[model samples]
Target: MSLSSLRRQDAAVVRSSLALRPLALAVHMLAVGAAVTALPVYAAEPTEEAVTLDAVSITGEAEGGLSDVTEGTQSYTTRAAKTATPLKMSLRETPQSVTVVTQQRIQDQDLQTIADVVNNTVGVSLNRYETSRGQINARGFELNSLMIDGVPTIYEQPWSSGEIFGSLAMYDRVEVVRGANGLMTGAGDPSASLNMVRKRANSKELTGSVEVSAGTWDTYGTLGDLSMALNEEGTIRARLVGEYNDGDSWIDHHTNKRETFYGTMDIDLSEDTTLWFGASRQENNSDSPAWGGLPVWYSDGSETNWSRSTSMSTDWSKWDTTYESYFVNLEHTFANDWHAKLGYTRGERDGDSYLIYPFGSPDPVTGLMGGYGAGSYKTNTTQDDYYLQVDGPVELFGRSHDVAFGYTHSDQDFDADTRGYIPTANYDFNDFYDMPEPDWQPLTDSDASETTQKALYAATRINLADDLKVILGVRSTDYEKEQGNSKIKEDDEITPYAGIVYDLTENLSAYASYTDIFLPQSQHDINDNQLNPIVGESYETGLKAEFFDGRLNASAAVFRIKQDNLAESTGLFIPGKTPPTFAYEEGDGATSDGFELEINGELAPGWNLMAGYTQFDVEDADGEDVNTQYPTKMIRTFTTYRVPGFLGDKLTIGGGVNWQDSIYVYAANPSGVAEKVEQDAYALVNLMARYEITENLSAQLNANNVTDEKYMDFFEAYGAFTYGAPRSLTASAKYSF
Candidate 1:
């Protein structure tokens, strides 16, 4: 272990030097990445419930005079997406709170990943930890539903990015369903669902793009996407996307890297049907399996701000992970008013990493924070999953009604191993630090185990009238786990969902929705059996409007939610026969409420706006503050305008601003927490100007974090903290054909 630590420590020095590498070159490559086309013309362009038959076409993208409007209440698409946008419309006309982050906006703001995009959208809060290194939540709810081309892709928890990183490059536009989608989505805890629309083969010719980026912390990476027609008729389409990113964490000594490869094929199985077959693979590298996500402060019990730079593992800190997935989908349209679809997906994951954190130390003869005997969770994960769903339209009465119903299921599993080493187990605390990298000392024994889950769900949509619609759905899941124990930890649960949309006028509407999301507990009972899955429900209502025939849209909404089956983790409770351990007590809770308002669309001749406000409260079973870890009230906004360019509208300039109020951070437990730290509200500004040197070529510049405000981004219960990013700027030239 000592030898391993020395090598890693040496690597750290090299890494620190690497972080200082120039990023301007990387930015130049990225800014020109997507604009790879050359010289002819510089042109660019850019969720259902469990209900089976959804009929509402409530979106800002409906084109051709909104002639093909669905009977449903809301839906939106990009200028070139699932649906065409109406002619010359304003965003305020859409009857839903929508925020469209255009590619131009993405570039202007230097948005790096999908997370960056969502973080910019209104009413959307990204809650993630630099440590723990996993999971994205909205409205304090874990994101469970992900849609690719309208197909649901549920990411398994305790899972790695080997699966998610694939979607980042292939995505063309990202649409978010802010509330319950149980009608077709099945089960959700009432947070938000995201749909990643893929770049299609709609173009007549060939198109490709590649991007590279480098930023603070020596972060540099590349992504490539290429699309082509496989048939003379241009009916069959093929697309491939790949990526490679390697970088370090904000903290010292931590490292991360990932690579992705994906291929997708689309065939006109028939005029009325399209067939999709695709696969993706991702590889990940890291030293710590714990993902540095664990809190640094020990709830005021001990080790308060001890050392933020301490390595969690003494040895075996490097982790290697990989994931592969394949999927098949069919979309068929019949001569009748009926349409049906089916899809199946298979995914697999494997990982091996080391976990090292100071568990405890003995009394020091001299004294130091370090000690010998240490335990580590070093292991491999092997997971496989399968999912299936089918849906079509159904008519009930004479009144025109559209309906769709579908069922989905998946099986997931993982294994984690724990290892402990006491190379001088008898050494006194004083000598622990005296010995070089004592935590890296020799290993002793190791143990392993796994957890599995199975889920089933269905949903549908029903059109009530020319102005009203209803959506409903449900999902049932079973969670089972075994951790070196004979008894099995089993749990069965069901979540329900519903939504309604009412059109008051051709350009105005009202909508309401509810959904429940569920998840199995990560903590196990004394029996080593998994605990019951936690469940949450969300209820929401809102009003929306669309103008210029749905070219633009705006909306206001309010919601309330409740969560149950939460683990208290008292750190004070012990099972009857179980020895006193980490007190993770069990408890139930509910009652969280919030209101939101937002606007997204073309407001004027060439102006756009995306803004939102939210006030919320989350409590425990006793109706007390459980979500005090974060802020309760916040507002965000962004606006941009494409001025009638000079030299015949060829010279374009635009800019935007992002601002937020102070947020509350919890440094300790509710009882022992330090004084709440109030983060001063700050804003970041960005500007962009492009000159059409030729029809196909142009020069552009982008600046981000304009204010250079120094601030903290995230804070955890254990007092762990990370700082926000500093300012950055980039310039590039592009050619499109």
Candidate 2:
């Protein structure tokens, strides 16, 4: 909700970028400062050319929010690193719509939760609720890919409607790569990929900071981040972040509290090679977890579906979960301008949520008793992953080419169980009033179900000419699942990708890319016949440029995505041994095609900006032109301006607007007629000004939803809708040595 604080954070990055010497490390750090340091949202504007083409070594987005553009961006990047550290370059240097929510930004805005951070980020939507369970919607796709320090940490465990509630308190910055990333991702959903960078050793000597906050609903919390340099050479550094959050929501039947501890170490083995290691541990406990979405309307079965509010359940027990993860990565460079990077990680998640919802109990037609059925269920999840990558300048024929090649593999496992239950409801009660807390059924034993997957993939990038560059990639996955006494194994074929970029000027470039992904079947069909996974592909083209030695940047892009041979299951045969049966009913495919334009950069003095817009058109390959659930278009913009000299030297004022177009969901009919549920387009205006009380202390007032924009965040699965948030505000102060 706080936008101003974010702007000041950007000012801090600009300040840092300006102060750092032109050391490779300093350049790398400053260029990408916006992501990890929490820079203010007010980025500078795009000028003539962001980065000079001669210096356009990497396809640039590096023109960054602080940098300007000579050519359009081949991609749109969030913020650049503080310095021009090629090894640790900024996101702008990467040709993609990548955003970095830095640590400073995290503090300035008082963004205490992961959901809060995602909301402030461009091109992302929150589909998840509750502290223990979380979900995020991206470019009309559900996110299923995640990494910690460039290591795989995502699994099939998202039961509370998502994998787990992630906290932002321990992170340095969040990196998001929009669109299909299966080329480097190995095996997973192509929707998008997120890399949560943990706080690493930064203090040249010894430094630390602590933050505490209290908000509505008795919400209170504390956070601490510390760092130390073990040697004068500053080659060995260590950082630690810890947080404890305890609170209750407006819900009547739930209580919850959570804690986390994270530690990271970085050693500059040598100027050519650096090694890093990170670990994280988290714990959560909650009661009456909203098993699912609240009904759109209640009692009379009338849709109360109102805006500015949404709710889950009451009295969901212990609902506890534990997450433990560790990772190690190394990067090296050769005299021939070649570089190699390798990383490995292990992650594990265990938890359960208990709930029994209303099901098959009644028929108004017969009144013979069949309105709702009740049952208790629990789920268990686990995961393991490994990856290796290497890219360098290589020789092809007689041409000197910039080549990048890498490979990755992943293995994951998941299981669940359910038991019978009895409820006090034989009658229809949408209000959930006068409900009965009946006793449990003495079922004999708990039933179990399990699933697993293994994948391997490789990819490469080639620079064919000074004006033309290309990239290619491929991946394969082996998957399996077991239910009761039955098991099934399947294979997802090769996923490949290719791209090309053309430099129009010394500061401008145009590029195009094609990427693909293969997804596995959801559940088993009747006769337990196997169904192939869908092959999804994306086509994109855009422009890019960098400015101010990569201090500022800007980009614009357009794309088209399509999926073929989609598998639709049908309940064909009946009375089978496997119990539940499904059939693969081949149908028309689905395609999402759209155009996007983004402007990001820092203007002269102390101004910063980041904005993006997306428009989508999707339908079955048969061309029925169905009203898609995804927004037709979205645009979000934010900026900040620092005051001149005197008493105002340390003060900054900033704010921006975020808007989204209407969306449509299937109608109320059993057949689901396409009901164009129009979500009125609303712009969120935010304001904030920060003043440095001291070199180590600062205070900021952040206000969000300035206009009290009302809207729906999610609707589709079981019900019609859930509303978004209303005008809200928060304030905070921070101190750092």
**Who wins the lDDT comparison?**
2
lDDT of 1 by residue, 1-737 (tens): 34234334433442343221123422332332222222123223422211111111112122223232111212222322221011112233222234455444554455545677666776566545444343445565556656555444544435343333333555445656655444334434556666665444333367765556665557677767677888798678887888778776645566678787888777777776777678878777764433333333342344333233434443345567676777777766567734455666666666554444332322222333332334444344444444443434566786644333444454444555555444543433322223333344444435444545455655555667777776665666655555554334444567676767787766566677676666556665555445566667677767666554343455666677777777766444445544555445457765666666665544544555556666665555543444333445556665655557457767666666666555555454323534444457677776666667787666666666777766554545334444444566555555544
Scored by lDDT, model 2 comes in at: 0.56
Find the 10 residues in a row with the least total lDDT in model 1. Answer: 49-58
lDDT of 2 by residue, 1-737 (tens): 22234334433442343221223422333334334234443345643433311111221222212342222231223334311111223433344555655544555456666666666666666654233455665665566666655555674444543343667766656666667766555445545667665655545578887766665456677778888887888888888989888876645455668788999787878866668778888877776655544444343333454323333443433476777877777766667756576777777777655554443322333322224444454555556655555555567876755444455555555555555556554654334423454465543435444555555554444556767665555666666766566666666666676766676665555667777666665544455556566666777766666554544555555666676656665656534645545566544466665555555556544666666666655555654333344455677676666677946588867787777665544433323332234455567787777777888887777777788766664445555445554565555566777
Alpha-carbon local distance difference test for all models: 0.52, 0.56
> Candidate 2: worst 10 consecutive residues by lDDT?
52-61
Clash number by candidate, in order: 70, 102
